[model samples]
Target chain A: MVSEADSDEALMELVKSRDQDAYARLLDRHMGSIYAYIYRMCQHHNDADDLTQETFLRLWSRAATWKSGQVQLTTWLHRIAHNVCVDTFRRRGPDDYAEIDPDTVAVTDDVPDDDRRRAVHNAIANLPERQRTALVLCQLHGWSNKDAAEVLSVSVDALESLVARARRTLKRELSAYQREICT
Target chain B: MTADEFADLLDCYGTDSVAWPSSLRNEAVRYAQVSDEGRRLLAKSIAFDAMLADSTHVPVAFRLRARILERIATNESPAWWSWITQSMWRPALLAILPLVLGFVIGDMTSELDGDSTDASMFLAFTDLENFVELNESTATDD
Candidate 1:
């Protein structure tokens, strides 16, 4: 019986041994963030759901392959989720990611009143795939540049460059909206 | 850090000084304070960061967690395989038992005196011939 107090590595050790309870606990610990990341990346609820499930399923099946100290569990999970989302994008083709209209973009009811946030969300959605991933991982998901770089399999400098370009684009796109909000 | 460097930091790390590389955070904060352009850039970065931080939170499907857990449950191996994996020593011991038995029999045979060994060897060969003869007789009868 693993307690909630167990570190992710400890739970993963048990998961490696086919411990369902430990696997369930790991799922509970990480499911939300992983789901949010997939949702943000793919921008479709159903696809995000399926991709998130696939990511965790891989975790369950590939638990033994995870080396404890080589990478943080969250970072490893993000890498898997990233790969799953990338595979989905490849299958769906680049044409599938149409521009997201701010008005039609689905968000929770709590944020409908914040036009600035919606605009920012739309701007992020419009970013090129790599830029969006870099920005989302660093800015929204709160991953450090190093960890985000590892997830993307890029150098830290390259990750920073991606994030810089993304921020510049967002700032340019949202300048008018920001001015309006200021007024 | 120069104002340009400070702005670059803002570009990569957003407006949060806490997220900036520790070695540069103090210099970046100092530049933002002393330079008008740095202040302007910092303010802009802060506003953008706030918008991003406040962006829509997409709720996971209410049943998604339960659905994943259920799928995992159904995907589990059969109980017997689960038992085998869970108690790996059982299979490992079973695997080595044959080799252990062979070694024990060889050890016993090696301990036999020379006369006793010859007699036992003769008895073994005779039993083998009898076994072959019985099989041949059975075939003739058939």
Candidate 2:
């Protein structure tokens, strides 16, 4: 009886042995966060879907290579997702990043909230890519600076600098949006 | 914590001291409570945290999760085959080794015995049916 109490490492040991049930449980446990992280990074529903799958597929294929305690499984998975997003971002033209990404296909409880969501989208999208990534990983996703830094392949100090700059940019952008809305 | 350190923590870890590294959390929270700058930064962090919490999280759609799981299941079968092909050599060699060792040891043991009945023992080197006929004829003569 594989319950939610099974540590990710335990599930992963089963996963390495090709236990589909265990893998499914792992997917159920993590798919939301992995998908959410990828979606927020790309702001495209289909791309996020594909990238999320790609991330898990990598997990399944590379299961044997995983070492316990070297890094947390979630951190490892997030790093894979990060790499997928970065590859995708690299393939896209720099000019493509300038425009507001279509509001994330994040399911909203209220239809009226779409406009505010788009405003948030534009605010995040307008920031420089690295800064935006640093913000998304640490601020929105609640990752520790060290883990987030590891994912970004940056020093913790550098990640801190990027997040500070990103926050300053997002604040200005959001304030501008608020002013425009009020006037 | 100094004002700069407090601000840095807020910048790097956002509003939640709970989410901050354990070593820094207590001091950072204490500083946030006592210092004006820390409080202001906490307010900003609070706003950001609220904004994030209120924002919609895009769940992995049901169909997408099913699709990925399905693919992984299908994908693993080939991997099992690949693993066998990649690792079978050692086992295969090990399987043949016992036979080779038996023949070598059988030859040495028979040589050590040096009995006239050794004719039967060396049967491996001779034609099997002829050896059988020779043994039958020798037995009849005896």
Candidate 3:
């Protein structure tokens, strides 16, 4: 049995050797976080589920690429998940809930409280693919700028810039929404 | 140091102090306490964080895990290429087997030259030396 104390590096080594037990342990360890991150990025439960499975399936085929001391296994998995999301979006359009960066947050007369939450989600979803990815990994998932940059395959400065642009967009949209709500 | 710069950090990083770059957090906090604009901007950012916090907790179905595990169980083994890697010595040896056999045969032919009437007969690669001699007769004729 692959124990909880066993490092992901150790588990991955065993996985490389065709150990079923090690693969299962790794699946159990990472599935939750991977699912959540994918779920947030894609915003569809079924797609998230498929993406999560695909991510691990990818790990099996691509296990040799993961070198220890270079990145945390979790970060590598997220990178896979990120690619899956980008590919999915490229294939199909954005989820309806978050179609575009909703510059105006259309509110005429009736303002239900739910609109704020929806607007935030749409704002998150509508971010350009890379910016959305950077925001999800760094903001929602709590990855550092460096780790997030490594996963995104960009320099830290580029990542910081994506994050800055994403936040600025969100801040501008939400600020407008806040003004609309108050007045 | 400036409220505008700190506000940008707040916009990028949100309300969480941990999210802010460590070098700037102290200066940011100091600025927030002293600057009216800093405090006001943080309050707005906090509202955004609050809104995000509500919806991010998407609970995945527990059964989803079982499906993933089952898929893993169905095809549970290293890739075909891995076998070539794990027992790499086997292929390495296989590659040199022809060379090793040639050297052994050469050594044996020279050493056993006087012992055998026909060097080609003994030198032919087959377990049954007589069959090798017969096969070589045809090979040499060709």
Candidate 2, residues A16-78, lDDT tens digits: the string is 778889899889889988988888887778888899999999998788778898988888898
Specify the CAPRI tier of model 2.
acceptable
What number of clashing residue pairs does each candidate have, in the order they appear? 0, 0, 0
Which portions of model 1 show Cα errors greater than 4 Å? A1-5, A100-118, B79-142
lDDT of 2 at A158: 94
Residue B142 CA displacement from its true place in model 1, Å: 55
lDDT of 1 by residue, B1-142 (tens): 7767887889988777888898998888888899898988888777767666766477756788888888888998875665555564667979999999999998887776578888989999999999999999999999
Score candidate 1 by DockQ. Answer: 0.28
For residues A39-115, write the lDDT of model 3, one tens digit per residue: 88877788888898899888976787789988889889989988887888888865544465444376446545567
Candidate 2: regions farther than 4 A off = A1-5, A100-113, A177-183, B1-9, B18-41, B84-142
- DockQ, every prediction: 0.28, 0.25, 0.25
Error of 2 at B34 (Å): 5.7
Better of 2 and 3 by lDDT: 3
Docking class of 3: acceptable
**Candidate 1 CAPRI grade:** acceptable
Positional deviation of A30 in candidate 2, in angstroms?
1.0
What TM-score does candidate 2 get on C-alpha atoms?
A: 0.67
TM-score for each model: 0.73, 0.67, 0.73
Candidate 1 vs candidate 2: the TM-score winner is 1
